[model samples]
Target: MTDLAPLPLSVLDIMPVDVESTPSGVLRATLEQARYVEELGFTRYWIAEHHNSPNIASSSPTVTAAAVGGATTRLRVGTGGVMLPNHAPFVVAEQFGTLSALYPGRVDLGVGRTPPHDPGVARALRVDALALDFEQQFAELLGFLRADFPAGHPLQKVAANPPLTGKPSLWVLGSSENGARMAAHRGLPFAHAHHFSPQNSVAALRTYHREFRPSEYLSSPYSIIAAGVTVADTDEEARFRNVPAALALLKSLTGPPEPFPTPEQAAAHPWTAEEAAWRDQFLAPQVAGGPDRVRAQLADLLERTGAEELMVVSMVTDPAARRRSITGLRELFGSAPLPQGLAL
Candidate 1:
């Protein structure tokens, strides 16, 4: 086995809406998860932005970040990414700037270029899909955050309000070579969506490191690889618990998304050949097993990608099981070893 140094661990919460659970309940659960992870010594807790997805309750990560930031003392609260095409650059700066003023040194602004909605929904949101230029929008967002517009620029005098002593840390979230190059060009931190785009993770990380240039935000290249994980007392139990989330992911890809199904419901549902194949392929990169298995998988991932940080996302339907999974991961990676009875 390859000996790997312990890496910083973080959480990425999608605020999954389980069957029969209200949106408010899901949001509250997210807050509780943040607090729980903080106690377990996780470094950061990030929420994602997903519009029109019934299974995902987090549509506004900025609002969730504020709530989580206020609820916890030491945990860094941020957006896994706010899809930049959905909102105005100035609005994002002001919102995150206010968060910085309130939370001081604990806010991160992660931005991505993808639109969170379909064409019709995006039209409803009043975003011009064809005219959207991610590079321009990204540059504008940084300009607003830094208050560094050039002379005679129309918004040069318009300042993003609630300016604070220090700005929120900026990160460019990506899962592709183009996105990696963009982050490198801007000299910002990069986070790869390894959970969703495992195929591109290593290539993207390599591009980021190879093309990186020093800037005010960062003097050197820094990268995080975010992955899906679930750990239980035994490998069998962990695999059983992962079924519902795996089913949910398949549903999202195949058709109109549905709320997260219970494990029983997932097991009962009929699976077509194509769906089964897809599910297996998707599960290939995810970490799901006993403590020793999860620890080994994560260590391998860190070695392969050389990620400065590891962000784990576990979207199990059962709250208790979810908490236990996180706790198990903490124990596996932390200085402490697994309890005697639970040893692999």
Candidate 2:
């Protein structure tokens, strides 16, 4: 058995919308917190892409990524991921290529297989969603970014003032066996979304490592397990904050997406059977509570997955509380790297 110190941890926040007011208010809050997350010593800060959702402030990861990269020094910024089907290979290459040129070596472009939102937005991207396979599309897209394709390939080559020479390290984000296999087969790093797909977490990790194939980019497999995390000064406080986010998610999936509720509103709505089950299933693997509890749980999950890295997401509704949750995580893990100024 290897006796090594634990792997490092990072974070991915969805750039959540504020419950208090306008979308711009939420955008401002998200940008401010992105900088704060960097100060706490996490590695990369990622934003997810969502459409037609007021609750999620980040609908355009490329734009949000630039804002995040501009605001933070030393924090690797990129999409937690950008959904591939919603965009063309060339456009993705151009957007992220420009980002890489602007902030070389500190950008990550994780690709997800899901359609951006639903049937409608999928139509809007102007692609035949059903005709293309995501895994195949991802491969082609990465090839373009690496400049491995023919000079006059149908997809136009990105002509940035200073082009990105090589591909940024790619991560395959998944919540199932197929995703694990895809990442492993390509020898790219895998990030399992235990926060939302808790039931398959262990199984997915196992499949990833077992099927891993070595390639030029990776000599061995690398995995990052992301989980919903909320930490506080006390267990009670942590649990209290956890409710609003969980309720927010449940409301969206079952009912309609609504603005985040005040702590009072969240506390008032007693959990229904389905909501309870949803919370338990989703939060089953989450690392929560005070420092001791969080540390122990995180350590255990890392040990179980044998992952090279850990990616955490704090789904709290309050900005200050969310900041605290991230700060507390770094303190618990004791792995905050110093924040250096931006390189590119």
Candidate 3:
């Protein structure tokens, strides 16, 4: 057993579109942030996929990954996840194959089983894209990665062309036990979405380790737990930064979705007794405060989960705060070095 300590840290950029940030600006900011984090010794930088979200600019994780990969040289770059339900596994394999070709040895393909949270966005991506079989999709994706289609299979001869120098290391992204079990059965690393579903993080990771079976990918369980963290130089500043996204999300539960609120707007918005409760519940999983406070909270979380790595996604609209969050962690954690044989 290891002592409670800093783990390998990775970045999960959800590509949030803040009020003052345009799509182009978001993309540019993402690239710039990726470069800075790599310099600070983050292990990997991942882009999350969210389709048709008025507040999320990362609709195409791979394209954005290419941009991030092109911008930074050392840290791993790939999707925090590409939702398998929305696209054919074959296409995903080819896309990552090309990505691996371009960046070789420095790509991590984190796959998710779910589709867009919005039903309309799912259908618009493709008919029945939301209801596809995740297990089958995962199997086919692996097959395509290695061109290992079984005899008599229609795609026996087709491969993810351009040729892969190496298959991107695969990690299963889950918010529940379902994803953890799937990853365990295949011996792949599992990443629990503790940021979005902290309630399920412990149980899901326990399931992964308990049921894990040896496979080519792993002989034991390995996991990354993602947290929604907002850290600033001062505790007050961090709380101030957290309000914008929380308020915007709370308002979004009703009919029309609201654009991300600025810090000023968040401060001025009237808070109702009921709305305050909802916001508190929503932010329950997040670590928000100064570097020391954030680190203490994260350390407590790590002690409970025993996660092999830590991945952070700050959903707030303040890009400067996000940058400072990374810098603060750099001071607290120093550096995170990736494990050997983590990515194939």
Candidate 4:
């Protein structure tokens, strides 16, 4: 008989944008929830950076990671990731360098090149007028973060004071071909954004593995796939609950952000035929069903991608339900049972 493999998983704690009824309440709830999951044996807790959206409050991953790291003992805290094009290479090195120092052996640096927020916001963050070729910039940024750079060189070769002794693990996050190439060349871990860019995942990951070069950090290509999931007691209930959350997200992307609607309200609402098709093709692939469904789907996804890890992004209304979905997932993986006989 073939030995059963144990899959490692990490939670991508979304600083949810729909905290209208309780402003800053979601943030507080998320913090509390991360602690609970840590006790449940999760491998890591990574927060994402989203700007100009009412649905996601976390815009600075370094700061948020610090808050999360402070609350948990063994669970790793990191970015899902930090938008590198918006910040200077030196600044990023210094910030993450400080984080590595403070946390010491518990910090991770997952960097991405996309402009996470709106274009107007991107303009506000950029220091230069030239549009960045993220692949090249990402390559250079890698050099800055490590001590591998030669001395007496221009760019001041800031030898990472305290010398980056732990060598904070680095992962390159991406949703496209350019991103795949960069990660492969650097031999860093690659994270695919299946949650948003589902269409590009298969092609991008294949490109990464084919071109990967051996580097000091990794001898072979390693990858993590990030996806959006919603779970509940029954497949019907999961579908019922997931609609509003999905609708809220679609509205925010197409229109101005507004308060989250009740499940009934979302069900009653109408969507254009075109939008419906888009959602099915773009969003459905990333989302899976309840316990049995998610397990089978996730396992199949892993088999197809050969991903080393699965980073889950749960988008549900109530904080407890969101936590339950995560808990349900753990049980589905056969790692542990959900606390309190939770059904979802």
Candidate 5:
């Protein structure tokens, strides 16, 4: 058995916009939370991009990455990730290259092929959205980042500016076997989206490890598992806190997405048998309990996945509750501390 020693932890924030909160308010909260987690000794903080989603405010992760990077001294900031087909590879290279230039060694660029929006919204963003070949786009993006355009390549004359001081660490995000193979083939780090697609997590990770090759960025395979979590003083309280996010995810699948509901709203919700079952199934992979229970379950998860790192996403609606959960996690995992009162 692998030793149950503490592993590296990070945060993946979707910046869920509550009904009463404005986009600006969500952004502010995210920045503050990033700083707080940095104090808790989190290695990195990542934001996701989602378009046309009422509940999620992070439409531009590059912009948010810059904000979070500027606010904290040591936390590595990145996207969890940017949907590459939405924009030109050159633009992404320039944007992340600029971030690397500003922050030096504290920048990361995680890329994915999944479109965050539906077909119509995707067309609004790019006229030829449906025709995009993600594999080709991904290769082009890497070429720009590495400054390795072939001698006669059309983009050889163009350079991503301001030039990167050092290449930002790259990660390929996926929830499928194909994504795992691609990341492994390229020798980039891989992050599996276990939080949302729990069923495929093990298969994807196994595929990545089997196909991995050593490269410039890493001498061995590195993988991170992104998992959803909710913790409180007791299992009962943790389950209660998770209600809102669970209801929000269910609504997103069945109808138009809404802002995260409050605990009271979730409590008052009229759940049918089917809906209740759906909620339980959706939350099967999540870890929610008091410190001891959470720690044991997380250790089991690490043993099963063999991940080098874990990136957690906690979606409790109350700010104080969220902070307390994060603080509890830090203590549970034995991460090092910052100055007193910083995390609180």
Candidate 6:
């Protein structure tokens, strides 16, 4: 009926290492960016987990979360998700338990099914049983967090220790309906990967709401949707800033990730017919514009998705441009922190 109000915004970063930057530099930049965004009133700062990728430095999101949590006092920090097949359930619980002990009331634990990279890489990651065992392992992880198991269950005795006052707020991260169903069945909050998989996002969120069953964790449905946003002083400049992320993503889909491309490289590259088409599709769901246009696009998206919160992935290659994008977006979320009830 009317324009939707600006949604509560959060941050999701991969600590991208561009062709011009080193992994060490990107890591340091992540800490700096986390503090900056927290000061801007972003609800949270979460890192994505990606491995065997030259462009992404956040190979272990949990550890990165610890670093981010230490760098900022108020922002909730956690994995946008941990790829569950990469680690044991007990170990994941233990790791987050330690984080909760340190951060308390500010940690979030979001998990997803693993994406098998290359064959060799998948083998090296020990994810051979990923597809078959994901649900079982996911269940095991929740059990560890809940500290509840059937009577006489062997896992009952083996608990994830360092028990603390707060358990990390849990979220199920997905790009498809399968994870939605899993999250709904468990009554955990769901976060859809709309930035990468726009086609499935609406369906996934609807599925989550339709099938949701209340559990000890939550009494109602809650969802967050991630979107790629690039804002600048002008629409043309915003498009220029977003080009490198689209190009790097296209390259990664075709083969192993290369160094994240720089804006100069993006400008120099020839846009073939098919590549241009692919880039258009990749950028279609994302928002890239100056202030007025960005506000309009975000409002339209909120009305369409009905997400309680929005997680932003700014895809600017230059560190300064990325920071500008972050700062530019802070106005959309007003000055107050997002109000949330943690289901810990």
**Deviation in angstroms for 85 in model 2?**
0.9
lDDT of 2 by residue, 210-270 (tens): 9999987777888878888888998778878777777787788867688777767777888
Pairs that clash in candidate 2? none
Q: What is the number of residue pairs that collide in model 4?
A: 3
**Tens digit of per-residue lDDT, candidate 6, span 1-344:** 23235456788997777888888898898999999888776788899988888888989898899999999998888999998888888999999888998888899998988656578767887767636588888888878887887899879988888764543488999999998998899888999998889899778888998999998778888889899888799998888877888899888887877887877788788999999998878777888898888888988777777778888887665778888888778765565555643435
Model 1, range 1-344, lDDT digits (tens) per residue? 33335557789998788797978988888889889988877788888988888888888899999999999998888898889999999999999889988888888888999984588778877899888999999889888988989999998998998874554488899989888998898788898999899999889999999999987767788888889999899988887787888899787876988999988888888998988887788778888898778878888787788788878887786778889998887776657432211000
RMSD of 1: 4.7
Superposition-based RMSD of candidate 3 using all C-alpha atoms, in angstroms: 2.4
Model 4 RMSD vs true structure: 4.7
Q: Count the backbone clashes (under 3 Å) in each candidate.
A: 0, 0, 0, 3, 0, 0
Error of 1 at 19 (Å): 1.0
Rate residue 35 of model 2 by lDDT: 82
Which residue runs does candidate 2 get wrong by more than 4 Å? 1-6, 150-162, 270-282, 335-344
The TM-score obtained by model 2 is 0.89
Error of 2 at 81 (Å): 0.4
Poorest lDDT segment (10 consecutive residues) of candidate 6 = 335-344
- Candidate 5 per-residue lDDT over residues 80-196, each given as its tens digit: 998998889999999998888888888889899887457777778873765889999998988888888999999998888876654448889999888889889888899999888
In model 2, what is the error at residue 192, expressed in angstroms? 1.3
- Which candidate, 1 or 3, would have the higher lDDT against the true structure? 1
Off by over 4 Å in 5: 1-4, 127-129, 335-344
Query: Each model's C-alpha lDDT?
Result: 0.83, 0.76, 0.83, 0.72, 0.84, 0.83
What lDDT does candidate 3 reach at residue 146?
74
RMSD of each: 4.7, 3.6, 2.4, 4.7, 3.7, 2.2
- Candidates 1 and 2, the one with greater TM-score: 1
Report how far residue 60 has shifted in candidate 1, in Å. Answer: 1.0
